[model samples]
Target: MTLAKGPLFLLVLTALALTSCQSDDKPPQPRFTSDASGSQVGKASQREGQYFIEFRSRYALTYGHTYAVFGRLNKAGGMINPQVAGLAPASADAAPYVLGHFIPVPATTGATDGDLEEAYRSASWRILLTEAEYNKTVAFIRQLQAKSKLWQATVDNCNNFVGEIAGSMGYKTPSIWLRPQEFITKLREMNT
Candidate 1:
């Protein structure tokens, strides 16, 4: 027995329709968690005193146009003391700068008051994270550091490092083409 062309076409169309309907029933998964409990899988949150992830950018003349670029970018290492979200106290002598670097030398570094002052001078943007979320993010960065090889100027730079940290905090990773400035803008738009 042979099947007719019209009947075969109908059967194929029916199968496609059923598959599409099945996929539609499932809800889309969340990229990050905003729950205060911090129990949700793949979500990060803190209990109190906002946890901020900042992106600091520096500009340099590239080619002929002087575009806004990231020369030496930094992330505000977890919690800067005195319980301030974005502000770093100038008089706080013991304030340690917890920063991650792309260079092969341990993926992370610490700076004191003077270094922090210079680094914070660049245009910076902040996003709040919870204490639990902050701990998880720090762990993730440590793991990446241990496994990662030396940083490549073009391949694995500071922007890529920040992108990974952002991803851990449940933020969507921006396109590779986006510079630090553009990535921060996109992050602020999505977060706010």
Candidate 2:
């Protein structure tokens, strides 16, 4: 049968529009995954820029404590001493840097001052760092390898190695979910 021009033209136009719209076969999914890989924690030390502290043990996503730690580091100028203000607050941000982030060495924590070396050696491995986190930590040690010259500026290993370096430089607090690109902004700021 012969078709009318107006209806036929409308049908063809509609079909073309539909085909083009359907090209994007699947609607975009959230791409959510429980895995931490590909996330910021996975790319630790990809650049020699700022460092970041992962939760000593990956905390539940719902937990606010991890963010508290991040905030403490950011606010404390990168060194949250465990003896800060009577360990004032119970939350990670308020307490002296103990628990997950650091070992409560009497020296580091300002409890006793006999031999810090022994304390560090004993406490270093006590924190629950992952293989990747541990590796970055080791690299941090090598970076801060004790200097002989007392006059030379001390390499801030506490800042660099413990992942507080980023906080020290200043970008934003609680950047636990910060991407590499985001971390770089702090690096640039510190360098400049």
Candidate 3:
């Protein structure tokens, strides 16, 4: 080769060699982190006094009370007029049935971040799917669990485990396992 081209060719080869030798393995560290006050770091908390909302307002995602609100609505013949959420009785009648709700965020004011928070607040649950959306939520949770240090701590059930984790993000636990259908049924019973 030429005199100047020799050094350039060697540099390129060396870079390629180094890149090829790099490992794909991730370093060991906890997937979740916290702050000085024992609160989770990053955006792991949710704002209080707001309902979970998707683009169409048909899908609501919530953990404790907000989820209860949805249940209340559904049981009331598919609508709930909550005083806190500023929802009117008429609003529920017009909107489609809420679907695929999640309680990923904590119900704390100004708190941010919960893996499931935003999706709960802003997903399209009205579109029917062959599979249960909660199943997908559970799968996503498993992925999160894999990334966490508490791998040994099993999520024996979806609602229970999700509630426990949500507490870490700053939410109160509900007294039930709370699958979508059950939630709807519970709400209906309460209203009647």
Candidate 4:
């Protein structure tokens, strides 16, 4: 095999092994990480003008996706134009998503079309932020968006993306390699 193909071949083999292995021995039952039941999507304080940033996970075909939602709550405890952002391989084709497992692919660290939808949501951890704190965090996320330019399943995937944001905010983050469901749950447990 050519030198270049040698690395690619090994990567494919490794990705296959990783994909075949289960995240844990846990049951296949649907693990719901949020109990908000759609009335709300995450836990937050009741006071108005309380900003919140939620680290969230949602189901996908394979490992799933992790993202962040940040916004100010109205008097009724509803989010006002909640913003969503995450890192994912930039493509609509399955080839890139699958290829991304073995090598870094172009990434988009901004909104995905379905990020705000509740349909696939599996987990969330919300932190209430004061106005000043909210501004700081939002600015940091924007910086992340600008600097984050690649996604690889093993190295800097979605879980790792969210973990970076959480860790920056002084929250304890679990292993970035965990499946999204487990990662968010562990994040909540470690903090609360």
Candidate 5:
């Protein structure tokens, strides 16, 4: 059957997409335990203080969120001292999510509530970092966070945020408008 197109259709489609991403009724874990690669403590870096960055896209269907995760690595190449960040509207209310569809809204960077929740990750790309690279990347993230004041869903949205971070890390990013998962998957494909 052919599909209908209009405001109501869009609303219903969005509702279905969002609803499909709801958790499987299982409660989230107490704390984030692993990076997107799956190993947290097992893949320590070649040296102490070495670091890693992983760009991730979490579920919400086409509206899924994208963010970056970084951390120190122990001598064994496993991740440690993990940190996360992303660009998003300052509020978690439906208003921002919806309003962002039209205009820019006050935004914040640094980890939001779901950044550490491993269960939401639908796509990710990771890279090991040297001490120098780690320091620079972290500094860049801070600067980006400080300067980024607004988030517009169709403009400088989450994928743009993650893509900016990825670009700083020297990875070629896919188009920012792609769904979070597709953007992330393309990121890995282009880089690796």
Candidate 6:
């Protein structure tokens, strides 16, 4: 008995079609670091030796007023004093009623490393990220600077800025109503 050529061709074509439609069943291969240790070193640990964000706040002369500063630790280390950013009154008349839309400013202006010591009393929270994650976080911060109004004192102020940056680094946002000191405590609690 001879099999017909048409039937044989149809069977082969059907087999090929079914094979093409089938899903791949192989498990995904695992990714590993170049070290061969099977352990991954985080980005913060890799580049900076460490990485951190600090919040510094002090009570102003006005009873209800508090001035807060936020900064990232320099890759050189905290001993070098991180570059801090904050909001200050636009003018002397702007004081006391500091709750206006002020622009974001570098709190420490033209100050030497020696000066930063006396200028800020701060508490910091540290984090670790992969190199890719660090780059992504930086890009997010740059975008924020470009688009966000960065109005100080009024409603969206320094605390909001820091909180947003921290959140990008996988941190939870503290209560908007919390004072700087209280916010620091909350950050520590969440990070720890």
Best by TM-score: 4
lDDT of 6: 0.42
Best candidate (score: lDDT):
4
Q: Where does model 4 exceed 4 Å of error?
A: 1-21, 24-44
Candidate 6 residue runs with Cα over 4 Å from true position: 1-51, 55-81, 86-115, 150-154
Give the alpha carbon lDDT tens digit for every residue of 100-134 in model 6: 42334323211122213432333333444445654
Q: Is candidate 1 or 6 superior in TM-score?
A: 6
Q: Which residue ranges in model 3 land beyond 4 Å of their true spot? A: 1-144, 147-155, 181-192
What is candidate 3's lDDT per residue for 1-192, written digit by digit as tens? 598898886566445434432423222112222221233333323223222211011123322212211111232223234211111111232121121111121122111222134333311121111134323433444444454332110122233433433344333444333432332233223322
Model 3 sits at a Cα RMSD from the real structure of 21.4
88: Cα error in model 4, Å: 0.3
Candidate 5 lDDT tens digits, 1-192: 235456665576456445434433222212222332333333433467667787787765336788988887677655686887888888868788677665578998877776667678677666766678878989999898889999876568888888888788676878766767767777777766
Query: CA shift at 173, candidate 2, in angstroms?
Result: 8.4
Q: What is the C-alpha lDDT profile of model 4 across 1-192, one tens digit per residue?
A: 599999888777576538633775233223222222212233343568778787887777776788999887788767788998899999978898888877789999877766777777777776776677788888889999999999988788888889888877777789777787788888877776
Q: Higher-TM-score candidate among 2 and 4?
A: 4
User: For each candidate, what is the lDDT?
Assistant: 0.38, 0.25, 0.28, 0.75, 0.70, 0.42
How many pairs of residues in model 3 come into backbone collision?
9
Relative to the unseen true structure, what is the C-alpha lDDT of residue 81 in candidate 3, on a scale of 0 to 100? Answer: 42
Candidate 4 lDDT trough over 10 residues, lowest sum: 31-40
The TM-score, computed over Cα atoms with residue i paired to residue i, of candidate 1 is 0.44
Candidate 2 regions exceeding 4 Å error are 1-128, 151-192
Q: What number of clashing residue pairs does each candidate have, in the order they appear?
A: 4, 1, 9, 0, 6, 1
